[model samples]
Target: MQWIHNYQLFLFDFDGLLVNTEEIHYLAYKTMCANRGINFNWDFETYCRIAHYKSEGLSQKIYAEFPELYAVEPSWEVLYGEKKKAIIELVSNGAVQLMPGVSSLLSALQKANIPRSVVTHSPVELVSAIRSQHSILNTIPYWITREQYSHPKPNSECYLKAIQLLAKPEDKVIGFEDTPRGLTALLGTKAKAVLVCQIEYPEIPAFIERGVIYIKSLDDLANTQL
Candidate 1:
């Protein structure tokens, strides 16, 4: 809570940090692999490697490791189309839900008049779909999606752009991220970074070693004085 008062701007990652959509994405990938008969079973380690990239970059990262997939797998366009369709079906059927503590934390920030925004690798269409189904977007005045940036997370370009857009000093901002790469991107900027450890990943120690604060959920901040 003391940290919340230290920042003038707050930035957040979308998938696992704000919503439970990461599981939806994982399911989409799992379904795609099954349909293609690809022997794909992702543990946290493997997921972390490609999780921070945008759709195209993720495909490229996966293909580099499994070149055989390049031949057997559908083009990124086709594969992503299928993934999006799957997400749409799941969300439309009331299968997906927001992560716990998201509403309360956002409301707390709003009540304090802190400027907050989402910086995510998700494309605008996907973001729009989730927003249409939920009221999450109402708490955020601005967002930087993949479509707005030339480079995505782990590259630092998107975070840098966000700071520029906010016109705030980097030291006066804070970022909440759920992945290693997302943390790296935020650290590249002037903002203090926190790791929302909703999912256990093997690289968590490394992040902690780098001085990133980790929290179980946004609810942990409820007792913090704004």
Candidate 2:
């Protein structure tokens, strides 16, 4: 808990950490694949491997794994467009929901006047939809989305950009992430990383071995000094 007090800025990953959009995303992907006559049987275990990547990266992974499908329909742009449409429809219909403890944590941070931002690979349109549904965006000063960054998670560019924008020392920043890629990106810099185990990741020990802290939810931060 003392460690949480050492940081001046807090960074959060969007999808599974701040909001439970992973399931929605999975559904969208499944629908898109089905529309194209491709069998999308990715379990949670398989999805976790490419979950943190950008839309293009996820498309490339899918294409690599199923070349036959890709050969039949090789346009990643088309697939991504379909996925985005599905997500937008879902969000518009009030299907997406914020994660547990996110609202309280944001309120606490607001009360403490601690600077916070969301660093995510989600595109602006998707982010905008979520913002429309949640009041938390008003509390966040900066949003480092995929549109702003050339490189995504596990590349360190987004995190480094966030550090630069926050104008805080790396040691003064702490990050909350739900995926290994996001954790790796945060740890690559001087910022301490906390893994919010929203998804089923079996590689917790490896993350701890790399000096990242692991927590089950944002509610756990309530016990800290803040």
Instruction: Find the candidate with the highest TM-score and give its number.
Output: 2
Q: Model 2 segments beyond 4 Å from truth?
A: 1-5, 53-57, 64-68, 200-202, 222-226
Q: Which stretches of candidate 1 lie over 4 Å from their true place?
A: 1-3, 37-74, 222-226
Candidate 1 lDDT, 18-56, residue by residue in tens: 888888887787776667777567765467556754535
Clashing pairs in 1: none
lDDT of each: 0.78, 0.81
- The residue pairs in collision within model 2 are none
Q: How close is candidate 2 to the true structure, as a TM-score?
A: 0.86
What TM-score number comes out for model 1? 0.82
> In lDDT terms, which candidate is top?
2
Q: Give a tens-digit lDDT track for model 2, residues 98-191.
A: 8888887787777777888899989988898889889876688789889999987788999888888885453478888988878888888778
